[model samples]
Target: MHRRHAPPPKLHPHPSPLSSPATHPVPYLHRLLSAAAPAVSPGPRFAVEDYLVDTCGLTRAQALKASTKLSHLKSPTNPDAVLAFLAGLGLSSADVAALVARDPKFLCAGVERTLSPILAGLTGLGLSRSEIARVASLAPRSFRSRSVVSGLEYYLPLFSSSESLLRGLKKYKYFLSSDPERVVKPNIELLRECGLGTSDIAKLCLAVPWLLSAKPERVQVMLACVERLGVPRRSGMFRHALKAVESLSEEKLAAKVEYLRNTFRWSDAEVGIALRKAPLMLTKSNQTLQSKSEFLISEMGLEPAYLAHCPVMLCLSLEGRVKPRCYVIKFLKANGLLDRHWTYGTIVRVSEMVFVETFICPHKEAAPNLAEDYDAACRGEMPTNFRFTWTKNRL
Candidate 1:
């Protein structure tokens, strides 16, 4: 087209008056200012604003602001020097002073805690104290103190001895189940069977540090908990137990136990007997089809592998118990085994097994719109079931 109009001439950036060799690199001037700043000594020779602009390339206004903020920490009369030192660290003078005033003892304690294991491990290699101190100091933040002596003292003895950091961590586990009210009774042997090791146990403590504060007896209760749940020896009860604690509320736990009794055809007395035993004893056996299958029932959770070893039985008996037929249907549907088509005639014959294995419902697929309703029932979400599933015609 009509030869593109000549492009407007680019305006060359006017060279700054401060761009001469002496002032060319502003950042370099700041670096120079930083290097020239003296340590915190009682002297009032340097004026903050004059040095900031002349040496650090800062505007007079910025220099004034920095000086004012830093006046209390560095000598007020020589603020420029202290400001430069702090600016080098990308910190304000106020920040520097605050950091300086903070007690470092807590920091030292933390460092000692972290280094205790490493220092012990190195002692066996015949490292000298001076060498150790140097290495520990170089290891970083807050290790430069004499007070950490006790921390080191406590850990140093384990070096070269048969004991190890792992052993010490394990000692923490024994403390967890000591309290009577909160005892966990985890099954360590089951944990081992589940492929967990000493390292895993240590990791568990780290994940829940409060476990260390737990009484040893309470910890024992938790460790033996899987066994008490009556889970099979071959199952991964330990992991299941951990998940159980996460998912099961007290009401849910009881409901789940009841489900187990119904699903497995366990009698009320049988379920009660199992639960009454020590938690470890629960894991000693699996659900059994007892001789009186007509009178008893048992069921377990979807993840009942852990509960298999627990002593709490989920079973209830229909032999002497009386309830409305509607109640029985609700219970069966709640546990997910209810089938409305079956009349009272069909259910009563196998009442024990059917009631244990199935849930009750007054109608087919009751509460279908209740999202996760089916799952919640399967999980025994209800607190209690007042009746049992019954049918009359089929028998």
Candidate 2:
């Protein structure tokens, strides 16, 4: 009696076209209804810090630190997918943990859109799954970018092999971020233009990857400095020379050049001759140059000009090859076992087996303890025969 209500509309066995599930998919219908429904308060906002610790395996400290980036993370849905994708890619728990700690925001990225495409492109480039995983773990910030695959493609050929590329990448943290076309490609092209072959470029890039990654203009200047050092582009040691000069400023390089000249008592022309022969001398430390000069010039009685003529001698080890072999040669000479004079360079550069065969084995009966004494001298010990050589020199 309070009010008359209209009768309820009769239900049809078949649903109306507007409400048909075929026309409006079930998921779409659910979404549409949700959109029309009045807003209800969402459950207590997702606990990002706790989720990071429990699900992502982050330490409380890591979670606390990483949570700041994911403060707006409302659910674990995207992170769950991302973690699953990483696992499928063969990333170990440590890899995932390290990656997340480095870039917590990476977890919130769309897996289907971002991660899958990046992985596919890298695979197409012939990188094994494991290598790709390591790449991601090594460069989290770069891995998040789509441009990383192209960067790797540019580097792979320059490195010549994946193993070599990986080794270089371990030292070069910016491999992924650097612009290959602008910075790296131009430097490599310049190297090629200077008569550096592919093999030579590969060796230099592995030795100092930043050479190519450095700003092209900066690299051109460095190349000019190298050219001024008197190392002809065709010299076998040109790459070695390049590595020596790239790290040093002009002032430091000048200091090194002066130190070498003064320490070796070289005339200006002689300095150029020595550097042209072994450009690696520019990188030798003051102590190294001093020690070698003292040994070759003072103890061995070799002329400064002789060493400058064969600067490769300075590249040999003082304690290992130079001193030990020189002592052996002297011991042989003092004992009258040698019939002919042996060049200092010949003794210093011979292989261990060759030295043992030509020097030790040939006179094993004459000097039974020669091999033993040589071994002792190599370990920086003073052998009796070595002492005898000194006595002979004094006499």
Candidate 3:
């Protein structure tokens, strides 16, 4: 029952594929794997081997991966052999270079599978490593400066639209349309009021196309034409049109007409014709006065004969002298009082005397605020039994 059992057969640990030394000729792999593998039991007999294995502590997994990748990188067909050989697993030579070059330690994954293709594309475009690095180092805004036009036309279009471009163009169209100078709104308005339509305005602009490029000025011109053409006054001649506006008169319409006639050297007949045509040229005052006078004499009991003499008599009272008496004539003419040929100093003096006696003689007052007898006032007396009659002569 106590029979001795044979010792269990000894089991040996199977060597890992990764345990084999790297045979790849890639110097980067040779250096990396040899340095990375753990030191053998007695430490390397050669100082070179001892230093590498002791200093770098690369794991077996790191060595095996580096060797396998370097095998492919060593091929002539590989575009980036040096870079690929340096890369372990997915890393490239460019990635190692960047990592070595950067003064500060960074946690970013070295350019591996994802970034390698981009570097490859850059290499295909004939971009040097330094140029790629420089571009990569630049911020987006700085990079755009390298190709502003291309950025706007092509790249920006990817983000914007033709309509957006048109809006920008419209905003700056003034600069395109005309000369920077020679643009003024009022001047344009002057031209437009002179009877220019939109087409005419456009033609004018075409004649001076550079004006369109002018800001406010070009816009002003177009607007002016629209305003002038759209209004009732056909002729865009604003100043002349304004002349017509200034011609409107309500106070002393006849006097204003005379003034205009004298100022413009127009004949009375012509002036009268114009006034008749545009009755608004007469002011409300003149209209009212005319209507009042017309109503007083024709509709009321006031006599036209007495009213006709009123203005001349008033002139006599105002003049304080019986003279060459042109003043009397002026007064009569102004008030529609004179005959067509009523002149001559003899007649004037006679009329003055009559006016002075009949109207200019002062009058008296009986009741307070009573209209007086023209003669009684001259005598400085108050008349009894005063009738409150109003007359131009008393005034």
Candidate 4:
């Protein structure tokens, strides 16, 4: 009943119906969709999947996988620039494809920041455009890592020439990815400590770069193993021994040693003697050991002691060099075309030209089929009925 109740407490104007939550309630999911729509939607006329397949040479599946990493790309401007830069460097479409396939993120790399500097650095290193292209094609991953320039800088001087460098790069692409300070340099130092000079080390790196890339401790162990086999570090055979040991695993070495001992009934001393003479004997397969030993022992009546003394005879090709030459010698002796004084070791160690002339050319008149048979045996087409009379008197 108050006379003037402040004009009924004067309510503020009601919120407009347009702005009322009850009148136009936006669901939570709808609000989220509205907020995120801009980001998830594709740009007009720019489809990343399509761009990858059509321009980058990726298949639909590859593009789909690559698009996950490149979702931020709304247009082809950056990738197009990357492709253009690669193409301008003489990379064929196949080369570009290989690069993208190996590392799809390459497409997203900054040209000026990442790729251009690498290329410029390569060129500055005296790599011609063609050689650079070859490197890129052969090892695209070489450019994807940050260590390429450092790798090249460390390795370039080790090679005698740019041709050698190119050969090493092509042969072992892992050179670009290898850690010189951690892996290469330490291993090289270990090799030097083992009496390898700079030139010898360079030869090893060219022939077997993986050996230098091995763990330092492992390389040291291998060096020790080689030395334990009686190969003197100062001897020329030392390098060959190192190469053969580097190619073998511990299990393989064990297996080969066991095979030589058990299969040939060789004592440990004899095996050691053989291995010291020709370390490559340990690298031969078990089948090769059996076949060659059988031919030398049973067919030619060569004593195992002889092989232990001259183990390099095992390294000769049984089919190509040993068997064919042996057949020629046997044929010549049976027909009295060759002197019986020629030894098995002498025949095997001779040059191919000498063997052909001494065994094949001289006897072609008396035995017209001798040269033909020798050639046939070399090609692995020897007749099943082929036999040679073993001359007991010659031995």
Candidate achieving the largest TM-score: 4
Flag clash pairs in model 4.
none
Clashing residue pair totals per candidate (backbone < 3 A): 85, 0, 21, 0
Give model 2's clash tally. Answer: 0
**Cα lDDT, model 4, residue 331:** 73
Candidate 4 lDDT over residue span 38-128, tens digit each:
7676458778888888998888898888788877887788888889988988988878877777677778777888888888898998888
Candidate 2 lDDT, tens digit per residue, 332-384?
78778777889888888778899888887776656667787788888879644
Is candidate 1 or 2 superior in lDDT?
Answer: 2
The segments of candidate 3 whose C-alpha lies over 4 angstroms from its true place after superposition are 1-272, 276-282, 285-340, 343-395
* TM-score for each predicted model, relative to the true structure: 0.24, 0.81, 0.15, 0.83
Model 1 scores a C-alpha lDDT of 0.41
Tens digit of per-residue lDDT, candidate 3, span 86-152? 3422334444434323311111223443345555654554445654444333221222132322322
Q: Which parts of model 4 have CA positions greater than 4 angstroms off?
A: 1-21, 24-42, 64-69, 387-395
Q: Candidate 2, TM-score vs. the true structure?
A: 0.81
Ranking by lDDT: 2, 4, 1, 3
lDDT of each: 0.41, 0.84, 0.37, 0.79
Q: Candidate 4: what lDDT? A: 0.79
TM-score of 1: 0.24
Better of 2 and 3 by lDDT: 2
Per-residue lDDT for 306 in model 1? 28
Query: Could you tell me the lDDT of residue 189 within candidate 1?
Result: 39
